[model samples]
Every structure is written in C-alpha cells, then in structure tokens.
Target: MMRWLITGGCGFMGSNFIRYWLKNHTEDYILNLDKLTYAGNPDNLKMIENHPHYRFVLGDITDPQAIESLVPEFDGIINFAAETHVDRSIAQPRDFILTDMVGTYNLLEAARFHQKKLIQISTDEVYGNCPSGQNTEQAPLLPGNPYSASKGGADLLCLAYHQTYKVDVMITRSCNCYGPYQYPEKLIPLFITNLLEGKKLPLYGDGSCIREWIYIQDYCSALDIVIQKGKTGEIYNISTGEGIPNLEVTRLILQEMGMSEDLIEMVDDRQGHDRRYSLDASQIRQLGWNPEYLFSMGLKETLQWYRHNENWWRKIKSGEYQQYYRQQYAQRHKKSTLER
Candidate 1:
C-alpha cells in the first residue's frame, strides 16, 4: 500500500482531502500533519481519527526537525499548510511569508533529501486579477495581496526545486473552495453563519469582485487525479469555470436562507483586492478530471450543511471567533477606512 503524508490535514480543504482519500483509495494510507492553527480544527477529521490507515501528527512544516523525521517514512507529501486568509495576511504578512515560503522550503528540502515526491497545493490568486480570459498554467504570476504573494513565492520555490535539484514535484493551483468544515472566516461560511446568528452580512465595497468557485469535493477529486496521474515538474490548474460576483453569492445565500438583502452591511473594501480570478484548468481536464457539482447544487448543499450543523459553527463563532471577527471587520465597518 502506498503511504502519503498530508500536511495541514486539519484545515478545510485538507480535511476534505483526507476523507476523500480514505473513502476512495482503500489501498493507500495517510499520515496527517497539522500545526492546528486558528483555522485548523482537528474536530473536522474526528471521524477518521481511529481508522487503521490514518494517523495524525501535530507538527509544523517550518520545523525542519519535524519534517526530516517524517520524510523518510512516506512515499509522497502533499503540502496544504499555508496562511490563507487575505485579511489575516494583511494584518500579519510575516506569518504568511514565514509559513507559505519558509515552511514550503523546509518541506522541499526534506523531500529532496529523501527523494520523495511532493505536491504543492496552491491557489488561483497567484495569477492575480484575470479581468479578461481564463489563466492557463503558463500565465504570469502577479499576486496582489500578501497571502497570494506568499503562495506565489511557495509555488516558485517548488518549481525551482524541480529544476535545480531534480526533486520530484508537482503543483496544482485551484480556485476558491467552499463546503462543510470550512472556517467561518472565509466568505461562504462567514455569510452563512452570520445570517444564522442573526448578524448582518459584511459585504465588502460594492461587492463586485468576482471569483471562480469549486466545490470542496470536486477540488479533492482534482487533487487526487493530479497526485495519481500528473507528471512531475509540471503545474496544473483546477477550476469549475464558474465565475460569480461576491454580491451575487451573498444574494444567493440570503435568498436561500429566507433572509433579506437589507441584512448585507456594506463595508470598506480590502486592500489590493483583485477584481477577478479565473483558471483554464484544461491541463487537469486532460488528465480525466472534471467538477461534479454545479454552482447551484454546491450552493444548496453548502447552505444545508450550515443549517443542520448549527452546533459545530456555534462553537467556532464563540470566544476566539468573536475576537477575530471584531478585529478583522471593526475598522472596515467605518466608511472612511478602505485599506484592508
């Protein structure tokens, strides 16, 4: 059986990937390593905590000693560890730089020394705003925010390792992913949980910024395909080709929840916010991978998940979440402050 190490497995997409792997790839085993940051919730993977083929390692990727000890025991490493929120990155760019770049470098070093295959999970933000056509794998990197810049730096590091050291590496850049177990700090879950809690949805600027949406499950499937069939030293884009405006997404959520648009509180726009993001994803499609859920269906399922799992989100929205939410949006609540 093939053995794999999945870093950041306690986070949203990572947890979904772990569950997807356990369910579909019975012959493979997974060792999950997560630093359990604010966004990393171990409860997300509680279902698989006791599985025979599953293991959890509480560690940080930036810790060379930690990665060095584990690299020799795995066949491949899929790195999902990153500081992902744009607001968080703006407030603390150093964290993003350290985690996304330095941490990735450590992983690359360990993987290179052990001659282990490595997969770098990245985001479409690295391509910056795609105001016109969809971006292919060869598109130029023009990251706008600290978070994207850090991710872009990590992507470059992975490519550099492949070219300079001949380390087995592959990269997959995906669009915005939404579904169950996502931290409420993100857009979709934030809006859903806000409405559920009787709070006004914080709508940024005019809410015209657009993003390509991909369901978490579909994203996991695409990652699996890349890991199994993708060629080393190559980059793949994974997208559903569904571009929707932030305003429209908020309206849909409000409509689905039987709430009103009046609850949307217009807030100051984020700093260096990209106007749009799109990915061609043709390369991954050539590898026999396609998104299964349409935007409408995915929205419905996501809303239903939040509706039924009130307790799960309630616990998250309490205590630390309240402090974070206030810190993130309190200044934006004013009309004069527009930066970040």
Candidate 2:
C-alpha cells in the first residue's frame, strides 16, 4: 500500500481527488492535510473520514515544520494546496504569493530532503490566455495576473529543484475543472446556486473568454496516471480537447437549469481577464490517460449535485465565506464583490 500525504484535501478538486483515489486505489493510505480555511469544509470528506486507509490532519503548507514532519513519513506527496481563486487572488495578491508560491517552495524543499515522489497539481492559467490554438507542454509561461503568476512561480521552483537537485517531482497542469464539492463561488456552481436563489448569473465582461473545461473526476484520473507512470521532472496537460466560451457555458448551464438567458447579470470584466485558453492534452493520452465525461453529461451531473447538496454550499455561502471575504477584501476593494 502506498502512503500518501495530500495537501488541500478539503478544497474542491482536492476533495474529489481524495474520494476518487480512495475508491480506486483501495490499497493506498492517504493523509489529508488541510488548513480548514474558509473555502475548505471537512464535510466534503465526511463519507471517507473513517475509511481505514484515510487520515486527516489540520495544517497549512506554509508551516515548514508541519510539512517537514509529514514529508518523511509518506512514500508520496500530492500537493493540492493553494489559494485557487483568481478573483480572490486579484483581491488579495499577497496571500496568493505567500500560499501559492512560498507554500509550494516549502513543500518542494520538504519532499526533496525526504526523497519522496512529489506531485504538483497545477492549472492551465500558467499559460495565460491562448486566443488561437492549444498550448503544448512547451508553451511559454505568460501569467496575466497575480494568481497565475504565483502558480507559475511555484511550478518554476518545482522544475528548478528537479534540474538543480534532482528532486522527484511530476507536475500536471489541468484545464478549468468543474464537478461536485467545488466551492460555490466558482463559475458553474455560482451560476447554479444563483439561479436557484433567483439571483443574477454574474458573467464577467461580455463572457466571451474561452476556456477548455474538464470534469473533476477526469482531471483526477489524469493525476492518477501521473502518480503511477509519469516521468519525474515532466509536465502533463490535462483537458477534454474542447473549448467553450464563458458566455456559452453559462448559457448552456442556465438552459439546463430552466433559466432564461436574460437572467444573466453582465458585470465589468475582471482586471487582466484572460481572453481564451486551451490545452493540448496529447501527452497525457500518450501516457494512457483520457477524459471520460462529456461537457453535457458533466454539466447535467454537476447541476444535479448542487440541487441535491444545498446545505453544503449554503453553509459556505453564509458562514465562512462571508466572514473570510469581508475579512480579506471587504474594505480593500470597492467593486461590490459577489464572491466570484
């Protein structure tokens, strides 16, 4: 059985990954480390907390001692920890730099010293907005804002460790992920929840920005391939080989929700908003990995999830989310934030 330590296990993608991994790899042991931040809710993993192979530890990645002690104890390290929201990153850039960049540095150093296989879960945002064709693994890094820049910076440190110190690290940059257990503030869930509440479906700018989307389960499957067979010091791009504009995606989700297109609330575009992004996921397919769910099926499933799990996001939309947003960016910005 593999002993694995996973950071950010309480977040959206992290939570889904943990659930998927446990069910698939029954022989593995996972120590889930999360800070239980405003976005993190342990209820996401309540179903598996008592699983014999699963363990939960409340902590932050920036805490060097906390990460160091655990690094030596696990056979592999999968880092899902980060300040993930781009809008929130724009609102609080310093936290992004600290958690996304510095936190990664801390984990890398710990893993390097322990000689553990480290898996860095990343996003396609590192390549910025690719308006035309898809971005291959060699695509130049051009982060358009603090959030992407921070993530790119962390990836650099991972590569540098591999080059300079021969650290065992495999990085996977996946396209925009959507599925169950995601924080309610994200694009799909936000629109879903807003529609249910009869609120405006906030669409940034003209909602024309294009993005390659992948179901969360498929994204996790790619990571599973990386952890099992991918080469160290290499990057894998995970996507569904389909690009959809934010406006069209919103329309599709709203249409499924039985909501009118006029319910969309057009808002000013985000600062440094990406125009489009697409990933060439050929490499992961070469490694015997592929996306399973189509966008239509995934969207329908996600909508049903939110509809069934109102209490989960409702608690977040009310308690921790309100306090965290206010405390982090209340008086700082004056754009009337809506928890994007």
Clashes of each: 0, 0
- The CA lDDT at 319 in model 1 is 62
Write one digit per residue (lDDT tens) for candidate 1, span 193-276. 998888999988999999999999999999989988999999999999999999999999998888989999999999888999
TM accuracy, model 1: 0.93
After the best TM-score superposition of candidate 1, give how far the Cα of residue 120 lies from its true spot, in angstroms. Answer: 0.3
Clashing pairs in 2: none
Model 2 Cα displacement at 126 (Å)?
0.3
User: Residue by residue across 297-318, what tens digits does model 2's lDDT show?
Assistant: 9999999999999987887776
Runs in model 1 with CA error above 4 Å? 320-340
* lDDT for 27 (candidate 2): 88
